[model samples]
Target: MPEVFTNELNLFSGQLYMKSMNEYLSVRRFLGLRSADQKDSEPELSGSSTNVMDTETPNLIKFLRVLTMKIRRNCESIDKTHLGRILDHRTLDDSDFANGMDMDM
Candidate 1:
């Protein structure tokens, strides 16, 4: 029915949809579903006798900075669309970011 189709469209057209898509992609990347080019782009871990966190902290920070920039660009792009206007009614909270991190852990 038209109503059913409309409902489905609504379900997938707003901030919730965007969040879900972002989470899915993040999980996939964390699970090593990345492309060859992406693998090449990543910095290699050193085999030096240093703490793992010490070696990885810089890379993690750099990756987060780049990811935040890309997410901002995407949000800007989405804001130009009608769906963005609809989703603008909702606000994001720190919990959203924390939730994503918890999932990764």
Candidate 2:
């Protein structure tokens, strides 16, 4: 309904729909589709469907150098109550960037 009524539809949902359609024939169009090639463009997607987040988690968890520094600074300055909303686990005083997750890395 949101897709039909508004332009502010979730971009990620649209992306996932398109990705699924491209990866699986069941999700693809049965008519009015024109392709110049017999082979599928996404040969990599042939195997069992994988969790999208599993593939993307590594990239999502890492940020650019400057952004990482800003995050660290914010973490250090923020109080425990406020910071707890953003973090899964919290320390009493200084910000814990998760076990073994060094800011330098």
Candidate 3:
């Protein structure tokens, strides 16, 4: 069977980054990266704290925001020619349209 969609969407990349950030923070605290001063500055990173998300969480959030912005910019600048190929009827499938047809009898 022929492929219906030309554009591939990788959604797990975002979730992977979040997972890695959590792992890194766990490793950092496990290795005692937190300092006494930081304990006061970022209570979440304190060894006594229980929050899974700490100071490093904000950095990951910012990175994801920037990534989302870049994706939007890329979409805005997409080459219409390539998109046209994906929109071609030969590439269209039931999933791409309502009820697999454009008109009703």
Candidate 4:
């Protein structure tokens, strides 16, 4: 039983980790950064050759703002979905429970 629980915990953790990684990749792609799998192969730029900060600061700021807004929207959507689920479970009738329709809770 303990081993089963440990396996389930590990599976859940792995799923969460994958979800987080996917989100990170999505944000990185949205911001025009290299994805994780491409990082190792991506070439490093020389700081002496170009002044990126001088030319790209505005673009970077815009990208960051867009990313922030997207994250906020996603959070709001998730909150609404969670709250709806909670309200639905709270409002389940006795007949719904007896019919096993409330098993989703």
C-alpha RMSD for every candidate: 15.6, 17.1, 17.7, 18.1
Candidate 2 vs 4: which has more lDDT:
4
For candidate 4, give the lDDT.
Answer: 0.31
Each model's TM-score, in the order given? 0.22, 0.19, 0.23, 0.22
- lDDT per residue (tens digit) for residues 1-105 in model 1: 443343334433332222444443332233223323345456432221122243464464344334433464453344432223223323333354444332211
Measured with C-alpha atoms, the lDDT of residue 6 in candidate 4 is 39
By summed lDDT, the worst window of 10 consecutive residues in model 4 runs over 78-87
Ranking by TM-score: 3, 4, 1, 2
Error of 2 at 49 (Å): 15
Q: Which runs in model 1 stand beyond 4 Å of their true positions? A: 10-76, 90-105
TM-score of 4: 0.22
Candidate 3 residues 1-105, lDDT tens each?
211111012211321111223433433343224533454456444343232345554464344445533564443322222122221211222333333333211
What digit string (tens of lDDT, one per residue) describes model 2 on residues 7-73?
1222212211122223223211111111234344433223322332334533432322123235544
Candidate 4 lDDT, tens digit per residue, 6-90?
3234322321111233332332332233323445466422211122333463575454334433453443322122212221222
Model 2 misplaced stretches (Cα beyond 4 Å): 1-52, 64-105
Measured with C-alpha atoms, the lDDT of residue 71 in candidate 1 is: 66
Error of 1 at 100 (Å): 38
Lowest lDDT 10-residue stretch of candidate 3: 2-11
